[model samples]
Target chain A: MKTNKTSRAAQAFEKSLAARPTGRYVLRLFVAGATARSRQAVLRVRQLCEAELKDNCTLEVIDIYQQPNLARDNQIVATPTLIKEFPRPVRRFIGNLANITGLFVELDLGAKGKIAV
Target chain B: MKNNRPKSTSPVVHLPKCPTGIQGLDEITGGGLPRGRPTLVCGGAGCGKTLLAVEFLVRGAVQFGEPGVFMAFEETEAELKANVASLGFDLAGLVQRKKIVIDYVHIERSEVQESGEYDLEGLFVRLNHAIDSTGAKRVVLDTLEALFASLPNEAILRAELRRLFRWLKDKGVTAVITAERGRDQLTRHGLEEYVSDCVILLEHRVYDQIATRNLRVVKYRGALHGTNEFPFLIGDEGISVLPITSLGLNHKISSERIATGIPRLDAMLGGRGFFRGSSILLTGTPGTGKTIVAANFAQAACRRGERTLFFSFEESPNQIIRNMHSIGLRLEPLVKRGLLRFHAARPSLYGLEMHLATMFKEIVTFQPDVVVMDPITSLMDAGTASECRAMVTRLVDYLKAGQVTSLFTSLTQGGHALQQSEASMSSLMDAWLLLQDYEGNGERNRVLYVLKARGMAHSNQIREFLISDHGIDVVDAYIGASGVLTGSARAAQAALEKAAVLASQQEAAQLKREVERKRAALERQISGLRSDYETEAMELRRIAEQVGTRTFVLGTERAASGILRQADAKVAVGTRGKPGHGRRN
Candidate 1:
């Protein structure tokens, strides 16, 4: 019964992601030096998507030292910059994720859960 | 038609860094400083160096909703918040919201030792980190000049200023770096040498027995701004600049004339009345019944069903109305009828511009056909002579544009109330009415005189009037041995004249007849002032129509068609409801 439930959840997530024309909308947070603030921000975003979004949103975390070129391409001015990739008008919000409302507004992830799972 | 295109400074497109919305700062800068460059705000101790810088940052964060960074050189986080809470700004809330980033760098000058040539790299890094962290578009360097005192080397200080300004410019953040301005031009440390964008000088001067705060824009590189010495006042609302004078001699105006409400006054302009939007100044010393005269005019308009607004800076509405009532002019009925509105407030509530702005706002909101300022001199407490002049001049122009008839009362000093010195206000007034008190022969008499009425026939000769429980009454004066008689002295003088006349013989009959004829001519002039008051008043707007201002030297007038109409109207209105009809309408 547990295996069946896990497979069912995976199938639901995969179906929603595949239905989108761009496959899925992804937000990548590229952080440098892994500051406690940055790590907390990543965990906060992940939990916010799970408890808030449930599974409709997808968040990807990146260490800039692992890929310096990605940081440059996205014009990351500082640590912990969240890049909204799927939206036609791309925007970046840089902070330690202190303002959740500002982050949520910029990322376009409201309670309606418009982002692909 | 001019095509205004931005002259491209660089290939990079610039986003408008949110406006600070401070009053004088915007006006002096032609709209605000260069969008993202660090403009240094410098001044001496107790000269508002810190407050202004903080105000700039706070205004950006709160008023304009722009994220800002305040790098304090002296104040702590708690101290800064406590200091600004008095201004009704929630500085702590803004900090908690992450909309503002304040870094209090406490570095004592004596403790820091620099062994080698070093730039302000660490400070720049921290500032850049703050800016990058919050995406702040506005920055304030409160007293960066203190660092010069802290750091021993002059070369490093100057270099650091250049580098810091350049970095702020490159990041495209509008920054303000406060410093201590020196007696010489530019800052003491010559930061003005590094930043070639803008420099403003704030100064306080006491001249002609008045402490006037003035703002002088020493330079603004890429903008056109008012280069004159602007009178500024710092109060609860911060600094406000006085109105700008129209150096241009021409402004298109409406040729309409409206009634001053007082029939006799309207007659002074000829039967046609005053130009719809002209400003009439009623000047007199204290207790000369200027308020009573203005109330009479306003009440008349209210009786006529036209909206009238009374701005009393000297007296409250109830006080003014009650005082006028003591003299028998019932202003309460007019106020109750909803045609008259009085707005009373202290002049100190705002600076001159704000006062004018408030007046203009009320005027616009009420849309009154006639406006009255009970004592225009009340503005003396809020601003300097030049500022008051500019404000009054703007008010006149604005009223004329809107076609609202306005009356202004000024309190003049010294013994001469009839021809009181109106050097600061005379030029803007279309009609000048002088009220005075004359004491001679053991009695004090109040005399009312119209010195100058532009474009109208007026009574140049002073007239006698009485104030009683029944209001103002125009009566015959006792022409005694010398001075004009009024009130009780006039009564005694009249008795003496009658007694003397009863004793006169027939030999002086011809001389009396000649004098009577001349007196009749003067009476005819007065009557003509009433008769043509309306008709000639219609044509009396010599203000703009004249080729140039032909200064009417004293009391002389050319009788016109409406002058007779005005005389008849006054005789009719003055006796309209009187117990016994005094004159033939």
Candidate 2:
């Protein structure tokens, strides 16, 4: 449950260092329904995460339409959803996965899905 | 609309009912088309669909004694009746006479829906009742677009429509069905697909920013129709198609060439005359005397003690007569004598078919020996290409069959006078005449040319015709210093050419004067040298005796005349040029 909060916080960071092996903590988000409003939200989230995480963050995005059943196990409800999978406990966020400022305050930073501070 | 599949036993053959003979319309439709056959009249906005329907019913009663039924899907009966009051249709009178039955159906199709196997029995019952009551031989469906949204499932409605058409055919009546046209195709939502016995499309297109109503007949199941698009007009007489193509029909041969009250025009047609009962086309640019020519035709017809019907699409009869009077057509007496009938209407008043029908009926009723429509292009708004063509062809054929002489005046585009009128309409007439504004001498002059006259020995000469107080009369072929004179351009051209020729001649004269002046100076110098040489010789002889020397050559003498005698003068002045060179040595 703490990992969920950390992943949420991680989403606020516009860029992640998760791609790097040394500081790698890869976070992936999957969304359904690439509608105008949902796409707008994704754009905001992507911007905020990149701006906050700086050089040590990595984020990968995949649409649910590309793989549907994966979303069911993830318990996705609303469209424009975001999932923080990989590196410990997975976390999911429903609604507009936007609000970079509030999201960065709750996401994790390590393999244990906790803030590195 | 070819209802019969190969297996079907007998296709119901419905004889096209003639819409009430409206002057120009009955001529185009070849006797009003099959009664209740649902001839679709379609066009874009303001293409005169409603007016055409009204005209057909009104004229049916007035002219043909055939009562009519008009079902309105677009407007109220009162509204349509009011709209066409100015067209001289007298719809209210017809209704009162029980000659016309009008049912204005205002139900919105969008709100009405038939979920199951609902039949249009109510509409048919109402229509049949109206038809039976009025004894209408002609039926008009104002528009089909509004009915579509009112009835759900177009496929079913289409089937119902098919049944309705079959019913009309079984009843043996002629029908004029109006359809709203989509922006892209001929009819909205392909209503044409279902009703296809004869499709007349009215087109209002902006070419060079001028909106013209053109009627085209896309398909005619059983009859030969005019294939070219014809122009139509709407006015007090309703829609009038202008194409008077005289196809293969026996025309009354009148050897008498009634002079176009204008001597200029009559002379242009021929010194003897135009074929007595032939159709004439007066075509020219605006203000180039097209109306004047039409008036000439009218006056000539009236003068021969023959009745003439003049249909003016753009101007009122009074205005036409007034204006023509100024240019020189005296028609007030003709109107009083009932020898001339002048009808004016806007081209947007009715669809092309209706306009033509009204014209034909009017012509037939008047029993006019001659007919004229001024600026026929104004009527092009009534229908699309195919309808106008069929209607015009029918009109000309009808006229020819009746042996009634006809003439149409077409307003031509600038510089393309002959082309706009003669080329397109020549095939439809026995004689095609062109009125043009030719530029010469910095002025525009009206020149007339006869392009083609079938079955007549017509003059190939372009004649000079002028309009004065009396009427139109041909003077002679204007043989000026330049080409021809017609209106401002041809007159100006002649002036310019004459000026150019004069300028060239002046230049040559100036050159000749300069050469003569130079030659005179040379002659004066030679004469002066001869006198100077004599004086010098006298002095030289006296000097040589004093000097006692052998004769010296003029090269060393260095006298004033020596320059004159330097070459040719040396031989000539040596005492009659003694031995030429030997004497000189």
Candidate 3:
């Protein structure tokens, strides 16, 4: 067990060195209620983050109807707004995550979330 | 201009009114801004837009019993509180009472890195939260256009502004949005597009080194507003607008009479005095006692136990008091009694609007029963004649509406007669008392006459207005051969008349004596003639008696009648010859 713990610590250090120093992406999605558009945005964003980011992103979905304080805190005007909280510059997107590539480009994540097309 | 015009031909929708409680502002807006809609107040720097917005919220909470939320984009809460403290607005107390909510939204251009698209949604959410929390019926976004300076995208700003206005309308809360005036534009971003319900433009212009602030309602959607640019003031009582032409001819009339200080002048006006709440114009040339008349009016008002407000443009309070003391008007006592208030300012100290606003503010605060404006003509130096007229008209209207007597003294330029100047107040005044310096009998004497007094009988005679130790004294009308006389001429003419009467009396006495002497002389002549005739008759009587005696003797000698007859015949022939000789002679 001691040998396995030592190997795991060493592997984690190497992994941290291998990954980019910018760290994982942090994002928040705001919506009015559990409407179809909100659900689609949530599902699509989660799919893209898991598929591309691969456990390298933290996502929080806030329903303005329920947790309006959070939505207000984030300056959410319209439903299904995506806010990129990580990185040096904060960015905003005001639509459902239909065009994943365009969302990545707007969020300054170049080609990271691009599909095989 | 096109936006200002009503769109529909149908009956206009009467928007609900919200009284601003800013004195004349409500009247100018025809009952305050269109209710529950955004009103854009745009002005240049230091034109009082922020003060107006803040006053809106403050007055809403204090006077109207409506809770308000002030979302300042420029000034912080402490700054605003301190700024408005002098105006008697206790913002902190209001906030503590949950009657007001202030949220300062600071925008740091350098700190805000505009890397992606951003909207003013943050401001909206905060404002909405404050409004909801406070249940505010009024909202003020002071200097809202400051966001435009911080943000880089105009398109986004405009869209957000449009949405914000729509949201405010949907919320049904009276909102005042202040914006910076653009060059040749009502607002920097043309915010007038979004706030279509009402738009007020404030202008601060320095004319001849004197700054004058004016406010005009550029567009009021469904209300009949005063289109003229009114003068507004941010004074001890915050924003107060002075409406130039809103005072129509609908003020209530009072038949109550108030005495003028001079009893003689009062007699000239009528028996009692000028009508209560009437506008009296005292116009004259320089040194015609306009100030003295105004002082007397104020003194009389104070003596009547009515509060009086005197606005002297040409003289300071102390100077006026001292000068009036010479005329026996003891204004110091009245002032000490708190019955008279003097507001003295140079006409050049401010623009016409400022003067009007200050006067209005004093009137409102003092709540005087009568107002005296000395030398309103001095205000003509601050603006055009029409502008002065407008200001004076508004003042008169305000006083008339409140049933307060107003006396305005204007200076006439030239000559003794009251000339029709540019702003001829004769037609508007209820009573026009013209004072002129009549040069007659080698002396210039101040003469007073009532040019017109509506709905009352006034003395038409020109009175020699004299100032003595007993205050104003108006001598009786001195009608003479030439016309109405005044000054030393009246006195000299009166003396001449007395002398002529005395001379006529002496001449009558002398003629009477001469006629008595003539009658005595005639009587003497008649008596003399009578005596002479009596003497002559006595002589004739004696002759007749002798002749009779002779005839009797001759008759006794009838025997010798034949000889006598022959002699008588010769005598008859001789008599006939004597008669012929006498006829020839």
Best by lDDT: 3
TM-score of 2: 0.42
Q: How does chain B of model 3 score on TM-score?
A: 0.76
lDDT by residue (tens digit), candidate 1, B1-585: 011356576554333333557775675565676677767666556656567667777788877777888888778879989987776667898889999988876554433333222345446656777787788988888777667776666776677678778888899988877777777855786765358466666666654444555667676665566787776555555545553653244545556666655555566566566666778899887878788888878877787788999998978899988888887888888888888999998887666656786787789899998999978888977777667878888788888767788899998885644253585587788888888777776766778777777876776666775677876665556665666767777777778878888767554887899999999999999998888887677677654455344323111121222254455644554444233222221
Candidate 3 residue lDDT tens string, B83-112: 889899898899899999988766455433
True contacts kept of each: 0.00, 0.00, 0.05
The predicted structure with the larger lDDT, 2 or 3, is 3
Model 2: CAPRI class: incorrect
lDDT of each: 0.69, 0.66, 0.79
Question: Model 2, retained fraction of real contacts?
Answer: 0.00
For model 3, what is the alpha-carbon lDDT of residue B426? 66
Chain B TM-scores, listed for every candidate in order, come to 0.70, 0.49, 0.76
TM per candidate: 0.61, 0.42, 0.69
In lDDT terms, how accurate is model 2? 0.66
Quality class of the docking in candidate 1, CAPRI style: incorrect
A1-117 in candidate 1: lDDT tens per residue?
999999999999999765533434566776765668577668766766676556566788987666654554454434565666654345555555655664554445554554322
Point to the candidate with the largest DockQ. Answer: 3
CAPRI class of candidate 3:
incorrect
